[model samples]
Target: MNGTRGTIEIHLKELLEEAGLSKNKFCQRAELQRSQLNGYLNNTITRLDIDVLIRICDTLDCSISDLLEYKPG
Candidate 1:
């Protein structure tokens, strides 16, 4: 089998903008730390946490698909 790689892109910034929510406000509402949310917004998070994802989705009233995109590399 050939080995290939893909990327999971986080659209948190766009989603937050579209929802008219500031980063700080979102952090408060989602019960996430600013640094943690920054990691997700900047796409620098090495590990994905299910609980965090759920909180984000719940706070934004969005599905997981709306917050992430998979790109073939």
Candidate 2:
């Protein structure tokens, strides 16, 4: 193995779970496009739009820190 391989990850699924929100309900409540939300949940998103992130934070009553975590390899 080489050096450290790690990531600062968005823990969207866990936050959603803690909030008791289903994908569909969250989309409707947060006014997020279904595809975008799906992208995040599935970890298939390449870029996260800041506007959308703010909207989600406001809607969920969570700070950005609440949705993200840092892990070491």
User: What does candidate 1's lDDT look like per residue over 2-73, in tens digits?
Assistant: 116878899999999999998889999999999999999999998889999999999999999999888887
Worst 10 residues of 2 by lDDT: 1-10
Cα lDDT of candidate 2 equals 0.79
TM-scores of all candidate predictions against the true structure: 0.92, 0.78
For candidate 1, list the clashing residue pairs, or say none. none
User: Tens digits of per-residue lDDT for model 2 on 6-66?
Assistant: 5567778888998998989999988898998887777667666898888788878999998
C-alpha lDDT values of all predictions: 0.91, 0.79
**Candidate 2: clashing pairs of residues:** none
Q: After superposition, which runs of candidate 1 have C-alpha atoms over 4 Å from their true positions? A: 1-4
